[model samples]
Target: MASNVQVLADSWIHLLLNLLGYGTIIIPGYFLIKYIKNSQYIERAGNGIFSRIILTCVYGNTYDKIVEDTIQAQKPRKERSSFSDCSQLIFCFLGLQVSYLTWGVLQEKIMTEEYTDLSGSIARFKDSQFLVFVNRILAFLLAGTYLMVTRQSRHKAPLYKYSYCSFSNIMSSWCQYEALKYVSFPTQVLAKASKIIPTMIMGKIVSGKKYEYYEYLTAVLISMGMTLFLLTSSETHKQSAAATTVSGVIILIGYMAFDSFTSNWQGELFTQYKMSSVQMMCGVNLFSCLFTSVSLLQQGTYFTSIEFMFRYPRFFWDCIILSICSASGQLFIYYTISCFGPVVFVIIMTIRQGLAILLSCIIYMHPLTLTQVVGVLVVFGAIFLRIYCSHRIKQINARRAAGIDSAKV
Candidate 1:
């Protein structure tokens, strides 16, 4: 029914689509689990397996740093704590990973019900999505209020800090997910992949990070990888090329902007709130659930989502798993950023993209072409370029320090 070129393109495009969809769900997730392992604060929340060891270390540093800087109250990093704290990190990481493993099924469930949630609410409230969105906001507001009251002895303005970080999540997810509804899978991946550029840009602009020429070179290589995949891919008549590209770009930009701001924002949380990592996580999700709910309800999507969720309980459960995994992952992500900073985190995230591309073809039972393989390799090369540069800088710094010490001697 189709020409060889068209069929080849279709098959290849399908492969890309799986990459985009799965990658979108997976990359951020791995970092989150990794983040939890790295966070001393979360590990210290209780007496358990991981909490006793890792939590003590994470929080010990956390407490020492925040106390020294903010309050001029000094505490040693190795001070012994009666409570064991590492189990929280263990549970958090395990819970997040389990969720990620089940994400495909859960996401499928959410996809079916999510739109109805927004559209259904429209009849009762002219801005029904907005109303439910408000309720979801109320949920997080409740968390913020409770934390502020309960933790009042610590510091003021956590509400403000959490508000900024959480608020960014609401905006970023809304824009990116909304745009995702209209685009193809591969388009989404490339667009999302392009985020390395804007993130690099924002990191330079807002975070005062510099980019090397290799980083630029890496970007070009990744772009080529994507372009090859795209060229070998077929188009959906659902939209024009321009429209699709624009939407993908918007998604990429939104992801980049919010993620950059949020990552930096967390450093403040780790430094200032000094709250347990789990507590910070609960705080963000608590807010996110509220915000997303209100936005959907005001648009009448809330009631619709509910109707479908109830009608398809099984499907809804899937979304529940996905949402929870996603939420927990967010917590891990905060820890990762706090532990390794944005650059390394991005490298890990991008590497996951290549894995996603590889797995999606197999998992989805799609055939990959030689060109598609080439494209994937090219993208990987790009990721390596950025990661190598980022890694090299750390090594260089250590060498420089050694040199300085020798000179001083």
Candidate 2:
């Protein structure tokens, strides 16, 4: 009876701590949303203590600036010639392939390989949060620099709004790194490729968006492919049964959930704000760095990670290059979408995902069964089918629009 009571007490303590952690993120977001919704109340409240507190803490004297910027209409972009567009499309495709492929290899290497510690003993760097901080900080710096160098529309979105997506982004990235400890890199890559299912689900839940029948069909195909891939894994791989453990599967699920939410939230922000991609990147990474640094500091691992980096020079260089690749990858994604449209960008990314898996297998000597190969082909084939169907739908819509315009004329 006493032991049972102790266990119950510990469970309550754990639950409470989790709630507290969530509240730290949620409570602030609640107020920010409230402020955005009730800006008139803020203006009318007029120097009251509560109003002043909200304004000072949340808006920080940028209320007028944000209002002005938000109300200003964005100018439409000029159309580019076909040759220049093709050139940019090729550049972005290559940049994304190189940056993300290198990033993937370094990521797997850093997570799976052992390095020398300060005491000259081999140790693996288990601090996933620290790696997240490194990636975000560098990306934040790069985004900010890009914004400074180029002429961008004045950022009008509430800076606090970025915290919501940043929280999810950090969680997703942390899960990605953590899952690598349990799952093979190829398994993780395949799982990531199958994100359309979760993304569709998140779209419905978050935005009440509806997907077409073919979207569901493609999602099911991807699921089947993922199941076949995981179920037919060879026993000789280094990860073996451990790769498909419940813990790893759960981490991957968390990764997909957070990643889906991050993308959906980003889309919503893009619709609501006229800021450039670099501005969005800058804002999100700024909050990401803040949140991750605080968490690392609280866990007392911030300085420890730094010391580990100093001890292992190779690891230091690996981290630096990893960060650079990540930042550059984001730029490539934006550039690709801007130049070639999302259909082409999706096609390029789908190809990159396939190459990333193949590269990981070759470099790591991960043996694949014939069944697994079939699964991979099935997954990619479904993705391409979905992409083709989407293109058809767009073309159909364009024809309909042109017909309506011609009839009105």
Clashes of each: 52, 0
Predictions in order: lDDT:
0.54, 0.72
**Per-residue lDDT of candidate 2, residues 1-409 (tens digit):** 6864574465345335434554676687787668665776555657778776556445544665566555654655575554575577678878989998888789889989999866678988977668878998999999998888989865666677788888887777767655665666567656755676677778788767777888788777876776566555543244433345566777788888887787677766665555577887888888888877766676578999999899998899999999999898877765554444333454466557556556667788988778878878887788779767876897798799999999999
CA RMSD of all predictions: 13.7, 5.9
Task: Give Cα distance to truth, residue 162, candidate 2, Å.
Answer: 1.1
What is the alpha-carbon RMSD of candidate 1 to the true structure? 13.7
What lDDT tens digits, residue by residue, belong to model 1 across residues 1-409? Answer: 2563464455346435433543443466456546866763563467687664444322334455555465545545663321232344345445444444465445544444433343344121122223224334444454466666675344322332355677675556555555565456656656655655666666666556766788777866776676566555433122333335454555556666887676666655665555555456656665456445544444456677666556655545554554555554555666656554555455445544444455666877767778878988887777656656766786797799999999999
**Cα TM-score per model:** 0.58, 0.73
